[model samples]
Target: MESKIKHLEMVENIIERMAKNCFTLKGWGITLIAGIFALSAKSTEQKYVLVAYIPILVFWFLDSYYLQIERKYKILYKNISAKSESEIDFDMDTNNIIITESVAKKLCYFRCLFSVTEWLFYCPTLVAITILIRILNVF
Candidate 1:
């Protein structure tokens, strides 16, 4: 029972650490993207919109990913927490509650989602801008 408690506490710590890392990554990514778009844009209307959209998309995807991770962690935590309270002796050696392989797989999928969505907005906007410049140059 004591072992189960310790194990759950450790899992909670790991989840918290992961959440922090995600937050930092999201912050830097949003800031850099917004800054680049703003610096390159000719006007506030263009720059502000693009800058605003970048963070929104980033946060939306990050939130989705975090929520998925949170749900899984919650489920695992609940199970382990309940076990700790039960009459049955939980052998920590055998019942260590590690984040399952499936959780890692889901996390990987979320990462891929972030990558694709981020590029979807950034790459297309860049290409469009390049085409516009070329057209203007021809005139």
Candidate 2:
């Protein structure tokens, strides 16, 4: 019975680490997307394309802001997990709470990335609609 509890605790610890790593990658992804958007905006000449990029800039801001929050929670989780490591019987409750909060932080970051995609996806369509309206006015 004691061994079983130890194994479960080990699994929980692994999960906590995995969640932290995933959030780190998500932060990197956000940085990449922001760089790409900024570069594209700089290289483009057309006014409509330039206008289209404003939303992406907003996405960049959101990504960088949340990345900071995720990093803080990750450190907090590591400290809590380390402090719990010496217990003989394994305190599952504290581990669960820390891990759950870490996962929640990751999920929030993921959600922000999704929001960025949604905004980017619709922007081109919006530009197209505006162009179509202008063309219709010509006829």
Candidate 3:
């Protein structure tokens, strides 16, 4: 039982680490794309501004996927932590917990992209991208 608890804690830590990395990568992607556009805006083709959206969107959706995975593992952690020693096992799988939330089980990157929390984070960048694309001729 003690070993099972320790193993679950270890799994939670791993998931937390990955989740932090996902957010870090997303922030870096935004920074890099913005930097590329800034550096090349004057000398490069104006249309290149539109290309920034590609990575931005990709990173945004990818971050959501990571968040989904993190949420699942968090759920599993809670479930395991709540159980009696007799109920806990070494199997530590998250799929069974996710099944109860069929909608969550079916969630894909594209769908997660539009999740309210994700939209709150990424939509403003998308708005900025659209405005930048519209004004590319001015740059």
Q: Number of clashes in every candidate structure?
A: 0, 0, 0
TM-score versus the correct structure, for each prediction: 0.46, 0.31, 0.79
Instruction: Put down candidate 3 lDDT per residue, 31-111, tens digits, no spaces.
Output: 977886886587556666767878877788678878777777777777777778887665657677634556565455566
* Residue pairs with clashing backbones, model 2: none
What is the C-alpha lDDT profile of model 1 across 23-131, one tens digit per residue? 6655665577556555646554443434445554565566556645655565566667766355434333313445667755654645545555444644565565456
Query: What clash pairs does model 3 have?
Result: none
- Report model 1's TM-score to 2 decimal places: 0.46
lDDT value, residue 89 of candidate 2: 46
Ordering by lDDT: 3, 1, 2
lDDT computed for candidate 2 = 0.49
lDDT of 2 by residue, 34-130 (tens): 4544554566432343343454445445544554454444444454545543443443343244445655655564454555443464355446545
Which model scores highest in lDDT? 3
lDDT values for all models = 0.56, 0.49, 0.73
Model 3 regions lying over 4 Å from their true place: 102-111
What global local distance difference test value does model 1 have?
Answer: 0.56
